[model samples]
Target: MAVYTVAQVKINDGERYEKYRERFGAVLQQYDGRLVAADDNPVVQEGQWSYEKIVILEFADLDAFNAFADSESYREIAAHRHAGADSLILVAKGR
Candidate 1:
C-alpha cells in the first residue's frame, strides 16, 4: 500500500527554510518517495486553514516513508526545517 505524508507549515524564516527545501527532494528520492503537492496558498473550501504552506509526499509504503523520515541524514536536514518553521506533519495510508 502507498502512504502519504502531509505537512502544514508556517514559516518563520524563509532563508533558513530554503536550505531545508533544497535538500528535501534528493533525500526523498532515496526512499522511493515523491512530492505530490506543495502550495504556499491553498484554497480553503471549508474550515479554517492556519498554515502558510502545505506539502504532500507520496511513498511506496509506510515503511518507505518511515525509513525516509527516520533516517539519520533526514534528521540532520530536518533540523533546518524545524528551526525555520512551525509545522504539523502526518502520515496516512492511501486507499
Candidate 2:
C-alpha cells in the first residue's frame, strides 16, 4: 500500500528551515519518495487551521516511508527541522 506523510509546520528559524529544504529532495530521491504537495498558505474549506505551512509526501509503502524517514541521512537533515519549527507529522495509508 502507498503511504502519505502529512506535515504541518510553523517555522521558527528561517535559516534552518532553508537548510532542511535544500537537502530534503535529495534525501527523498534516495528512497523513492515523492513530493506531493507543499504549500505555505493552504486553503482551508472548513474547520480551523493553525500551521504556517503544509507538506505532503508519498512513498511506495509503509516500509519505504520508514526507510526514508528513519534513515541516518534524513535524521542528520531533520535536525534542522527539529530546531527550526514546531510540527505535526502524520502518516496515512492511501486508499
Candidate 3:
C-alpha cells in the first residue's frame, strides 16, 4: 500500500524557508518522492485553524516513506525547516 505524509507548517523565516524549498526539492528527487501538494495560504472551508503552509507527499509504501524521511538527504534539508518553520507531520496509509 502507498503511504502519504501530510505536513502543516508555519514559516517563521521567509528567506530560510526559501532555501529549504530548493534543498528539499532536490532531496525529494533523490529519494523518488512524489509531491502531491505543496501550498502556502491554504483555504479552510469549514474549520477554525491556522497554518502558513501545507505539503503532502506520497511514497510507494511505508518503507519507502521511512527510507526518505530517515535518510541523510532529508536530514540535511530538515535543518533548514527547523530553523525556518514550526511544523506538524503525520503519515497515513493511502486508500
| RMSD, every candidate, angstroms | 0.7, 0.7, 1.0
lDDT of 3 by residue, 5-79 (tens): 999999999888778888887888877889999888888889776677889999999999889989988888888
TM-score of 3: 0.93
**Model 2: per-residue lDDT, tens digit, 1-95?**
99999999999999999999999999999999999999999888899988889999999999999999899999999999999999999999999
Cα displacement (Å) at residue 46, model 3: 1.7
**Residue 86 accuracy (lDDT) in model 2:** 91
Task: Tell me the whole-model lDDT of each prediction, alpha carbons only.
Answer: 0.93, 0.96, 0.88
Model 1 TM-score (2 dp): 0.96
Model 3 root mean square deviation, Cα atoms:
1.0
Task: Tell me, by lDDT, which candidate is best.
Answer: 2
| Candidate 1 weakest lDDT stretch, 10 residues | 24-33
**Candidate 3 at residue 18, lDDT?**
78
lDDT of 1 at 60: 91
- Sort every candidate by TM-score, greatest first: 2, 1, 3
